[model samples]
Target: MIFNIENSDVKVEIPALKHYSSDLLSFNINKLEVNYTGNSNPSIPACVQCSHPAKPMPDSYIYYFEVKINSINSTRPSIVIGFTDESFMLNKVIGSSRKSFGLRSDGKLIHTAVQTMDYCPKFTQNDIIGCGIAFISQKIFFTRNGILIGKAFDFTENFPMFASATLSSPQDSVLFNFVGPFGFKLDEVLADEKKVFNNQVQEEKVDCRNIFYLVKEYLEYEGYPDTLQALEEHMDLKKTEPSNSGVISECYKSLDSSCQNCETQGKICNFCTKKIIETVEAKTNIQIPEPRNHYNSISLSSLYLKNTDFLKNPSKNSSEHNTKNLKQRGILRQIIITGNIKEAIKYLTEFFPEMLNDELCMLYLTMQEFIELIKSREIYKALDFGREKLAKFRNYTVYYRKNYDIPISVSHAFGIIAYKNPHESPLAAFLTWAQLDLTADLVNNRIMMRTQRPRSCLERVFKHFLCMENLYQETSFVKIF
Candidate 1:
């Protein structure tokens, strides 16, 4: 990949070598390498120099640089390696702003003033720590030698970054290598990158960068510039343009607060508005268990069943009372694929005669053959459809459809098939065990009123905050995320 110096067409601009903290620190970047040379005092730090033309960081890509900490005058957050945008300055510390992130030698991540050790790795003299940033996940990672430590920082906003570093004492120095064992192992990160960009899998861990610095690296490695031109026409990571602080903060706050209640947690919903915009279908096979009979007086189940108050103080109708009485006779059980789908349907029809009018639903139910479910009902056939299929279904669907919006909403109709036992998953207890009785009670509530859609506590807080308007757009608010 070496190019002849005489005919080299590449335009390289290395950072102008200089000291930021007076004559306290010094470094050299000659011969296409960076090394801390000297230090006069420990008061100031040798930080960013003039614009050093480096490859544009990918919207999400991992590039490792070797950091051989040659000396340490003070072990107090001295040497640092990080990423910075065009705003990086020669007179300022490496990570002293929202746009800059630096990994300190003491195993902490610093963004301007904020420092955190949430995921920093140990760095010592001559230890080649691998440094990388994932914009999609808004995470920065470090690896000692070839081992990944963990994500170090959760960055706040998006910025086109370049590999950067700084030193305190003159003896406190570092060397950066962009080639070969780029400090970090490329193979280890390849799968994640592919999953994020190529395979297009819905994963939260994927690093998403709008720019493909890796592509430029490859072109430079292979000595091809023509491909680089064509690459610009394709999808550029810049299109993702990191949202403003207010927007980004709101999103992160929403996620942080709801992480516990989120069924998927950090497993899904990483992209901004991507999953929110897409609609996926839900499927289930297990039939809803009959409502459990209320025997115990102080039981939570009994309380849920008998409670008539809903929304405001709406009164119950005779039909609603009748439905409640019928529901009381039935007991809720986990939906089983092997169980009878007709049984659940029969219960529904008897309790809510209004469902009988839905010709489409009745047609699908009668046509579904549970021969395989019949097999599954046996210990051998009781497949882990709930664990395997339904979980993935929820990951895709996120939430259940309130009403049948599609022509074929077989999601509710859970049984019978021609060739297979059942295509739909059985209504296992895991899927609706805690829900069937409650949903049944809600349905049977005598009060007639519009039910509100469920909203997470995080959503309430975030929306409440977002609703307020400020003329200056700088009204201070408590920073949570």
Candidate 2:
């Protein structure tokens, strides 16, 4: 579902969130936090949106908000952020039901049973939590301050869910911040429901040193041994010993004992393998041989075939070949990208017959289905179906589509077309080879073979993130095709 984060004045009503309150309990906002005063008969519980299609929010549309526990009267007070289909009750805590899922303040996940306690950051008071409810993925996430405490809950049942909270003591209360003390740029906050199920959130340290391995992988894959060797020499890297590990990734294996890595408490040391490697290295000074000369490369332009071919040949045959090579019009590309399934399929049959095959058909059909949902304005079902379908292509051959003469990766391409009216703006005349040409050369090898396709890299994601350094930022949500 699309998010209108531009609305800053919106505030979640305290009454909607409270499922039940002790008759003596009173809730009020004090110092920017929701505060509750109760005379000790259990506590008050609350909810925000408790059903599918709650007002402006449609089913399966991801809803996000921030909550801060400003202060609690009890030292051992408990706080809960939970989801459930059941009605709120006075004495009930969120995880009391089999259908309900809850994340407790002490970092425990409570459903019918207490799962793990140490998985999340524990907070006492004055801490903010970024809470996200994703109906499409049927999962929830809680961010501690800014650090995203990943998927906290997954409820399989299709019943409507209400975002709920509970206070452990008469003194306990929590404030809802629909707007936020945001840790990340608003642009990075997820709005795309499709990315909810597939989205991977990782916090990795930026290292310029990693570029060396990236370049090494690139040169080896592209058959540029000479240039690679020159780079290694310039960088003063030691000539690596030829590996027996059979790994072709950026990281190489050391001859460290496998026992060191795999050993539990009492495994015996296996020194035989270590001894062999050491003895060989000591005696032979083992290293990969230097890269060879350029005799192997045969450029297509190198062969000179009687440079006067066009001069001698008749114009009639040449004209026919040129006509055969003519490209399909820009309009056909537009139709395919704009969700005109029937027309797009027709063009495919006439031009790219191969794209009408099973794989492409399945891809287009899925895209068409999602487009129908968008047209019908069924954001919930559209998000649900979209996630389920794209999950299959997790082990994707997205790179195969890099040969754009074929199609953009069906997953990425369809996403752009899904929201955009191909009839207008940038997409109307946007199939420029120059842009695709630059991207094709850069990221192709980096994809490699993977158990799962990665989300777009940060450089790619932030390329269109127009904001800079805090204060009244206006950033664009870019759907990269």
Candidate 3:
């Protein structure tokens, strides 16, 4: 049973009044408006609180509510609009305790009864006052009508804070716009805060820029000239190497020195050819005979081919002969990306038969092929493929280990057959582009390991940070990915 609809979006509701001091205040039919009925002392105001805490939106990191002054009962109507913890007394002013914060209509900011400061201009009837809580900075801000006033106070506690208001004058009423039809364009405020947070994160992650640079270096080292060229062009970068004292460096120098002679004789010089073969043998620790023709030896030139289009112009030594291996590997990678498992297997068999010897790589390819069949609703074929290829790995302990709980197992993956629409199942997280990307990356790593090349520096860094994230149960480091 695969469901097609996505459920990534979240819904946030507006805060509304739950209950208040019944003796001092009265509410209309709807709890959105409150009025002072009994005489509350000017200093000890009647407080009304919303039903729920001002919970931050997980993505936006803020919560906000606004109140419009509907009427004033006295010449000095001391209305307070702010937030307070549940422990605060409802019979007292909202800002009369340390656990509460408020902006009074008289243009004063108060955190405790004894501590008050001149904050902003005083508000009168018909003025909409908004109070917002910024969780990241732990600051409270106010707005008059639709204009933002400066922040008033900072709190260090993590207690739940509820939206609240206090009235000091009899018959003074205020209307709350919990979920709006708002007078203020709150979207702009949210955007600005998000931007500020991102800037702060960017400043802290200065080293992350080098990770992409490492990836660029890896593409070049792996002989992906086209991909390396595209990456350089897209990011406006230049190619750079970390070291200049390896067999690779010597080989490059030898080729450069002999380029003119090879171009004249229409074939690579034997010195440069021998260096290329030695480089491959050093990396893989596999001995091979010296090739009489460097252009025709698939075993020696598979990784060293610079120009794959050499067959079209054998007489021209400066053609695509150097990139032949890169073109073949690139095609294989594209085949995997396109989810053409059969074509990928055939390509590997034809060019890099050694990859088929990797059990893990074979398993990932077979699993991807099974998933493709499942996606096409070929249930009989999928079941047949699973029984033939995946049955033996049903209880494979390596995949089911606590640290590596892959969902695509015989027991878990076969459960999809029970659903009419598999995407609706809890197991649907495995049926995503993320899953395909994971398979492709695993196969690519296997290929790189088979060639005995060192793992990419970017991959090493990512794995290190991911391990740190798991060990400390912190997500900050993994956010870069």
Candidate 4:
């Protein structure tokens, strides 16, 4: 049956009863509902098992299925809902086999006949029994009528298991729900788990000072080792000093409360509402004392370089060669940002002439030049530039397509000339200041590739955190700190 997963975009098809043992079973046309057709015999029980196990989610999520007991034999009332591995014997009920687990009508949780225990209360006709496996933990849990019944069994080994149900009497009829709008509150359960996990994380003592070293490594990786000593001194001061300001008034307490939950917690507060105070302090000559903490008081401006002044006037601690390279790159960046593609290319040709050999960089410069020409309304010049430079690289455009947007951008840039007012065109995005800024960034990255590592240590750290956050979110619906 095809259906969507709760709280996720994924859609899955569960294997239905297509080829089950024919002796005592009758399946409906859709093959999702099954009924026992054999005589009511206490000794003989019929079970329908899926050939393949439920498909597991790549990430950490509970994979499970549910069964709605539509009708049951009033005399025996014996229906078993659960999962079984490949080793399971199709002739017997699921829990009777060594590699299977099931919840019976008598309120007993059974993992093989040898391992049985009274778990939750008995489930009967019209009741929905949800059985799921938390893949990461390798545990089975059951839910009864939208409420969770605790974990049933912890498996010692991983096995591919499929959903199965056994019927003891002829009157037994069941409907399987694989992908759901399940009766259980799966989203809420996941959210609660996440909430608990986050609370646990919050209670644990995390030395956020590790972030200080991450920043230091990032700055050094980006060629700013001299900034480390200054950063370390500032961090030490922040740790030692307390807030200099007096107690906040009742009216200002709300602002203080808002800052406490800022997204930039443990980093510089760039978009925090509390930065309003700093704006006021900077605009007026008023001195507003703030607590020397990481989140509220510090802004991004205080932490890193906003411009290339550091390259122009290098610190005594910096190497002369590195300073010279940075200064050249800064000039190239400025030239590109100012929309002077010709000047930037000339500057590159004079100093970093080898960079011209890199076709991707050349394509970017060519595209930028075309944009500049278009902006000046030199349509024929732009067309000529495209034919001479951009058109020649069409064969290799596919090769550069993966790493850069230049291929699609080249087409879009050319399309801009079709309009008398290019600004009104759908491809007008290529005309924006943001596009110029991106071109400058790409050129800057191209330069960095020759001189330094492509990605910064800070970017790797954030990516690592993001990966961990995703893993946490897979099991728990909410994000952990």
Please estimate how well model 1 matches the true structure, expressed as its whole-model Cα lDDT: 0.42
Report the C-alpha lDDT of model 2 over 1-481, residue by residue, as the tens digit.
9878897687745323433343534555332344455455444553333323221122224566667777665455367766666554545667777766677777777777555455575666778767676565666767787776677777676665565666565556677654344663333334444465355433345676456655544443322333444465567555443432222111213333344421331211123223333434344322221112222111111111111222133133223322221112222333333343444455546654544445534453445545545555676776787788855653443322223534344456445345545435233222333322222222222222111323233333344443442211222212310
Q: For candidate 4, what is the lDDT? A: 0.65
Better of 1 and 2 by lDDT: 2
The sequence of per-residue lDDT tens digits that candidate 1 reaches over residues 1-481 is 9867887677755434333444544446353234455434535655653244333233224444555566564557667777777767644676787777777777777776665554555566678877776543446677787787776667676555666777665556665565544556555554565455543444436443312444433332222222433343354422322212122212232333343312232222123112221211011111111222322111212111212122112122223433333222222211112133445365446444665554433333332222223344532332344334333332221111223212223333332222243324442222332323333322322112221223323344456666653311333311100
Tell me the tens digit of each residue's lDDT in model 4 across 1-481.
Answer: 9666686766655567646657788888888898888874454787787655865533325676789989986655379888888777767877887788898887888776877789887767899999887654457889999889978888877678888898878778999887677888666445554565567677888678657656754553344423643575467623322221222211233234345433333322323323433443243222222434532233322222322333344444344465555534544554565675766687788778989988778877788788888888999998888888788765543212223444463554466778999878766767776676677667767766766554665787789989977766775534322
Evaluation by TM-score, superior candidate among 1 and 4 = 4
TM-score of each: 0.35, 0.34, 0.48, 0.53
Best by lDDT: 3
Q: How do these models rank on TM-score, best leading? A: 4, 3, 1, 2
Error of 4 at 134 (Å): 6.2
Model 2, residue 79: what's the lDDT?
72
Give the winner by TM-score: 4
Candidate 3's C-alpha runs over 4 A off are: 1-14, 39-44, 55-62, 73-77, 134-138, 155-159, 186-195, 198-202, 208-287, 291-481
Q: CA lDDT of 237 in candidate 3?
A: 44
**In model 1, which regions exceed 4 Å deviation?**
1-25, 29-42, 49-61, 135-138, 198-481
User: Would you list the C-alpha lDDT of every candidate in the order shown?
Assistant: 0.42, 0.45, 0.66, 0.65
Candidate 3: C-alpha lDDT:
0.66
